[model samples]
Target: MRAADIDKLVSVGRPTIAPDGAFAVFAASRPDLTANRAVGQLWRVDLPDGTPRRLTRGVSDTAPRLAPDGAAVAFLRADAKGKAQVFVVAAGGGEPVQATDARAGVGSFAWSPDGARLAYTARTPEQGRYGTVEGLEPIAEAPRRITGIRWHANGLGYLADRPAHVFLIDVPSVDAEPFYEPAPAVRPEGEDAPKKQLVAAEAVQLTSGAGSYGGVAFTADGSEILAAVDEIETDRRDLSSRVVALSADGGTEREVLARTALLSVDEIVVASDGTVALQASGVGEGRVDFIAPAVGLYLLEADGPRLLTDPDVLDLGEVGSHITAVGDDFLVQSRSRGTVSLVRVSRDGATASVFDGDVEVAGHAAAGERIVVAYATPDSFGELALVDRGALTDFGAPLRAQGLVLPGEREITGRDGYPIHGWVAVPAGEGPFPVILQIHGGPYASYGIHLFDETQVLVDAGYAVVYCNPRGSAGYGRAHGRSIRQAMGTVDFHDVIDFLEGVVAGDERLDGARVGVMGGSYGGYLTAWTIAHDHRFAGAIVERGFLDPVSFQGTSDIGSFFGDEYVGVDPVQMAAQSPMAVVDRVRTPTLVLHSELDYRCPLEQATRYYAALKRQGTEAEMLVFPGEDHELTRAGQPRHRVQRFDAVLQWWARHLPVTG
Candidate 1:
């Protein structure tokens, strides 16, 4: 099997099971290399039969949720412009109704338990000054004339004066009388007729202060609501969240729960017994736990908060393991050996795997006793499978291998004696093929054993693709993951080069002399630094990366705070770690990619890098996306996303031509 062929077998997304447990909804996109630009769409899987059907026809429809009565499914639908709006469609599949009309966009939403009202958070335009404030006073002068609207920073958009507020929409009654009656009068062309005013829907503001609500959930009795807040303080980024009970009529609010430090509540599910089950994470070690009765799963209700299951529950051996809740149960995906399993925790503290095999389950959903799992094997892209309590056999038949061959995977030792795991996809029917070294972003994030589209594309185009998780990558212990701080271009780059050499040594099909490198964000920073420090790479692509830490610290939205964790000391360490400080050594053909609205890294990062390369007489080009932000890869402009992929392919083909 070739890596490109594996695209047909692997699927990645979280599915939502209906309240009745009769059906499940999920998002899937073709992973074919030739169809690399295909957008994701919502698909429905019927229980018992396990037959999957496509529901909405669009570029990408995500975050599917079944209504309380199971009459409709509400999801976020993105159009060609990449603007996502709240849409609802019949549970049985029919015309979709557009619910939101905001220009900024709608992300996470919730349908009230009563089904009469819908509460959602809307993104609004923001305008603010861009500079540092040393003391209590504003250091930069406020813009005299604001030419462009800033959205909510934090990788979303520029910040606006108005914050995202929760808006309540009353479901239009099927037989209620019209709210407005028009005046019946025809006047002459130049004469003005009597004006009639229409009744405007009133929007009730939930939380007032400066913070923005991240997620919302309705109580089982439909009397109160819960939300996560990320507040903006004077000096630091404080994320103090609480689960408050608000009057159904939108009047007063009483705090039922509160936390001191940073907390992320991913999902909340109310059990049949009125007990609230939530998946939450606190500051410090970032351990995910199931919070209930203010205690862990195994402990008695009277016994304070206990750790039901620690990090060792998944038995990932050396690789790290994390669990994500899917309805009543949780789905655990292991990154070490790459296997996914359905685990159920009983009130008695017993844990069992419902279904386990060689296939790596990417996502799962549960509805009472029925469960739906999405999985992909080494030879397959992705396929949907079903499981039930009493069933002894897996519901779906084994899917045929998609004819894609995956490359061999291996672990190499880095300069620090740490195990650096990587995968190498060799071209089919090839000898001495050009190579591409791909690095993942989120210096903290790791590339899992799951299937990827770009890897397949490079292999199909007759190039050996090598992707690795170097030092500072997750799945390792906290100390290993935090070692890259203040050493950006130093240790991290050395580990990547070590992994690349190890891959080429084992695979004779790879051409070491004709290799290229590319990455985004942190990965982009490394790509820029690699070419700047060494001329080994024939070509390079840097996407939405930080060129100069000093300038990035001032321009980025979280500039002040991110410096402490990423660069340690302060802006001084930032300048020393920045690739721009030594750009005169770059000699490779480089392509700089960035988005205009990117507040995470800012467009200036790309501009400075491109300018530096040109001044040094190096082959460099810049591609700026018009209305895109930091999420250009997963949630970028649709047309430009396709263009970006095409540009990468063309650039690689031009620099390193494929040989027979």
Candidate 2:
């Protein structure tokens, strides 16, 4: 597909089903090239063999949740000029009435058991700060007291000053206008004609003081709320989190439900029997645990946390995986072998696969025996599918008919006879095509069996793409993920090389001599390291690479412990593991791409690598994207994403032309 097809790309978000399993509501979004942003709306479909219909017409609406009684659906809606606010509409369809007027807007919300109230999270900016006062410009605001490690985030800057807190607001009537504002009292000329005073309902702040609280949900009885709390400490440099049960009445006391040493409490769900299920991962307090710990599903039992899934085998939180309590068991998204499928985990830890196939289930929602999933296969980007009687009924078709190409799977023996799995996608042609060795970031994230725009674009431009999940990637169990720990450029590097060589050698349609290597983030780091050590590629592109571990420990959002945890504290060893230390060895023409506002592997990484390469007389260039963070290639502005794709094709054309 061409880069401009980005505007036509469609994706589905997390879905919610009605209590009676009659219908489901989900948000689907597509890029708006005219506005240079994504626009989303909510859609609903009846159970079993029904067609989907648009429910809400907001510019950007997401996080749809059906009320307890199934009479209404509540979601977060944001206009073009305003922050997201809570809006509720009828389940059938109608106008959505705004239920919140939070100054900073809502982050997430959950419906109470009674369906009369909604518990949500919103940042409480300090007075006289963040435009809390009228006519106050950001330049004139008071200086921030920098004391916390999480003072600034990538997309949302300066987070420590305004911690997100839980709030409770009642849903407004269907016909109510200006729901958050009180109507002015009117009277006749004399003393008292007929007085009418309609006071606005105020949302009650549940939790207070420091720390950011979210992922909120109400207990079965609606008497209490469970939320994951991240107390950003000034002394410690970790994201260790805890779960607490707060009284729904805005009580000051919070009962600590669960806490771990190094694991982050990613998601929390309360069962009907008062049991709380948690999704957590980590081995110890050390930073190495953050490198590749499996996300496990656990039950916060009275005795202790009981792990339902094996930590080494099953990752419940991979690739947008989610958990939904069903009966006494939980239906969780489990990732393995580059595919995410639904797995049923019982209370006693007995596991059974609900839906296992050659597809990646991004997210799913279940009600009773009904399950709906937003999934992707090799030929389609994403589509909403319903699971019934062990069969999947897809609801939609792919956007483009011609440009999509299915990847051919390949396996090769690596170091010590270990198997490395990979895939190759080639354009429709007779002659051998120039190859692009594409590497996925996360070092811990796998290249799933899905239609990736990056690979498709390269194939459409007359270049074959080779991508693999080598060592240090997820979906292959914990050992494979942590194989490259403290030894970043060793086994993982060889595995990638082995996969590329094996694929090209076996395929007659691939031109190994005209190869161009490119990757982002950790992939960028490996790309830089590969070109520096082995000059086989004609050109290389490193985007948002972690080149220097020394400065990364100070500048990146997760840098405080990431570099030290991955490479170790030893100065000499860190230098040896860093790509910047061996940058002078690179002889390939390189193109460095980075985001100006990226907090993860900040812009300095690209700049340092490019400057060092230029100083050594190696051909190199750098491109920086403004107003975007590390997620530029995935979720950046629409125009910028197209521009990036254009730049990549141009780079390959100049260095490793398909015709040449």
Candidate 3:
């Protein structure tokens, strides 16, 4: 797939299964290439038949939640001013009614069990002075000095420095009288000050502090609320959160359920029986895990907290699983070995797979006896399917690659004698094709059996692309991930070379003489280091890679912390491991790509490496992106993202010949 082709595909997000399980709701955004725009709308899919239908018109809608009665659907919609407000539409489809007119935006909401009120968190400006106002004086007979100094402020100038608060909205009844009445104007003591009456509405501020509330959930009985709280402290990222139970009426009295040390909670789902399941993660690892270990599922029983499911029997590899609670069952959307599955876990520990395949499962819901699931894979954009508790039929077929073929996948033994896995994608109807060895970032991340467009594009362009999970990659275990803590370019880079040699021996389509290398971030750093240490590769593309650890330590945002974890030494050893320090050995053509706003591995790393390459008389070019951060490859500007891929493709084409 070409970059332009992949960019045309619609992006699906925030799939939600309806309460009755007869339908599912999800958001889809299609890119308008000509207008350089994106249109996001809500969609619904019927259960058992997997038929999709558009629910909302041209509006940016997200976070769809079905009411308990299944008569209405509540979702967050962005207005013309880009402010998110809550709106409710009939489950059968109709004009959405605005529920809340919050200016700062509303998210992380929960509908009360009785469906009489809705609770959500919204950003509010703190009333205080951010800094001293200069050249300010009261227009009076005598000048006066400003009295008080407040720590924070609200309004336009001080908006970004404000905090967030939780609020409750009451559902207006059809027969009841209006709850709000406009307040009358008030006059000052001597000189009358203009004052307007405010509406007589009932809204309670749940928590007051410099903290943020996220992942809010209501208890089964709707008597209490559970939320994850992160307060601003010395270390901004070091969040200490506990499941706090607040009164449904917004009372100040609250109690903490579970206290965590380093892990930050992400989402929470409360069952009808009062069991709460959450997705959380600690520092360093991005994988979200189910908090209470040894308890596959927990139940808040009369006696105490009890384990509902057996830990050993259930597969816990689904770290970032999404869970939905029904009457006595829990619908889990989990991924294991790159395959996503929708499973129903009963109160008695019995589990049944409603749907399972190579595709990625997004949302799942169970209403009464019916179940609905939303899934997406590399080949297909988005799919909505329905499955019964006991049904065995497959609603949607697994996605398969067309017109493109992958070379045989194999495992090669690393220099340390450990088996390393890799895949070789060979161009269709070709021989002796130029090879591009692609390395994935995240020394702790793995390149699994997942769909990727860039690799496929290389194969489509008559080049064999090789990808591997070198040492320090995850999924194998903790020890393998810890191997590259201080050995950066040594073991990990050699593992790639060994994997490439294995691919050359097994696949006849790959050309050993015309090999190119490419990677981003950690992979980018390795690409730069690879060409420096060896001349096997004919060309290389280093995208946002760190060239010198010593320079990165001072230039990057988290440099001080990362340098200690990865290098385990001071600036001296870091300089020794840097590719820029050994640039004289580089002989292959190289392209250095970086973003100006990348604070992780700042652009200076690339600039220094490019200068060294030029001073050494080595073939090198630098591609710097303006107004882009470290996420340029994934979530950067659309135009520059396309340019990034084009630059890499062109660079490789110029140095490595594509054979037919």
Name the best candidate (by lDDT): 2
What does the lDDT come to for candidate 1?
A: 0.65
Where does candidate 3 have its weakest 10-residue lDDT segment?
148-157
For 155-213, candidate 3 gives per-residue lDDT tens digits of 12222344566777775332333334445656576855544322123456687676667
Candidate 3, which segments miss by more than 4 Å at Cα?
125-160, 171-204, 235-240, 251-262, 282-321, 326-337, 340-354, 387-408, 448-450, 546-563, 572-585, 615-617
Clash tally, candidates in order: 23, 0, 3
lDDT of 2 by residue, 95-151 (tens): 987788788889978988889899999999999988799999999999988877667
What does candidate 1's lDDT look like per residue over 581-619, in tens digits?
778878899999999989888899899889988988999
- The residue pairs that clash in candidate 3, if any, are 128-152, 128-153, 183-197
List RMSD in Å for every model shown.
7.2, 3.1, 7.1
Please identify model 2 stretches exceeding 4 Å from their true place: 177-200, 258-262, 283-288, 389-398
The true-versus-predicted C-alpha distance at residue 524 of model 1, in Å, is 1.1
lDDT of 1 at 104: 59
Residue 552 error, candidate 1, Å: 1.3
**Model 2's lDDT to the true fold?**
0.83
Looking at model 2, residue 504 earns an lDDT score of 90
